[model samples]
Target: MKNVTFYLDFVSPYAYLAFHALPQALEGCSYRMEYRPIVLGAVFKANAVPSPAQQPAKRDWIRRHTTWLAEQAGLTSFAPAVNHPFSSIPLSRMALACSEDGAINRYVANAVFAHCWEAGGADPLDLQRLEALRAVLHKQWQPTIQSVDDEAIKQRLRANTDAALATGLFGVPSFVVDGELLWGLDALPMLRARLLG
Candidate 1:
């Protein structure tokens, strides 16, 4: 079986878009999807890359295109939050913790993406919204919340971010298959083709 490791952060609109399209894109492939949560802000800082929303032209283009792509993918319409580049530290850490428990991580990752992108939450930093996601997952929120700042957990987030960078990934929604790197939701078709081939 092929393995596709997906490196993404909860705050990325592109990642949000990819989440909706990926399942269908890889439908016929015998691939395992490994959802890796990383701190986008940390990666941005390390690479000196600005968020798309920070650049006016790119921000406007992403907003328009994201909506169009979502509609095309039959997903609910999406508009990235104004203060996007939201702090993903807590959400990322929680995702890492969930990963330790097996398949729950995928469920939590999907829930977080839906919570932020579909539910129109301002940011994952919003305690109420985070709590709402926890309720949906039927997991205790405080333990996850409290674990975010733990040194070991923080280290894991850093390691994931560094691993992403090492994979030659410059952005979110990157998929890695047998050392092949595919970035962006637009790259999914290519990834599928490669896997199928």
Candidate 2:
């Protein structure tokens, strides 16, 4: 089976779109995906660039583009986060807290993504919403909810971010297959071709 490393941050709309599109995009491919949650702001800083959201016009364009992309992909539930460039650190740590090693559980990743994108653009970091999420996750795995604040989980997220940069990945929704880096939701077709070959 082919191995794919999926790097994402919940703040990225492209990541949200790509996450939901992956299943069908490569339907018959034999692959295993390892999800890596990273602090996208760190990546921007390291790359000496500003987030698109920091640019008014580019941010607006992406908001529209991703919305249209979602509709085209038949993702009826997709919605932008109310805070486009909100701190993804807490959610990333929360996700890692539930993870084993550096590979996050797909279920946990999905839950986080849905929390960011599916709640009518609500802020995922809002106390009430986070508490609700904590409650839901508590039922799924008791330890997960409790571990989000652990120092180890926070460090792991940092390590993952460092690792991503070392591997030359600079954006969300990136896929690494056979050591080749592919970025963006638009890379799915190239990823499919790579996987099929």
The digit string of per-residue lDDT tens for model 2 on 1-197 reads 99999999988989988998899999999999999999899998999998988898998898899889889988888888767868888888877767767678778889989999888888888999987876666644536445677777887888888988988988888999989999999999999999999
State which candidate has the highest TM-score: 2
Scored by lDDT, the top model is 2
lDDT of 1: 0.75
- Per-residue lDDT of 110 in model 2: 90
Candidate 1: pairs in clash: none
How many collisions between residues are there in candidate 1? Answer: 0
Q: Over the stretch 152-186, how does candidate 1's per-residue lDDT look in tens digits?
A: 66777777788888988888888899998999988
TM-score, candidate number 2: 0.94
Q: Ten residues in a row with the worst lDDT in model 2?
A: 137-146
- Give the TM-score of each candidate: 0.87, 0.94
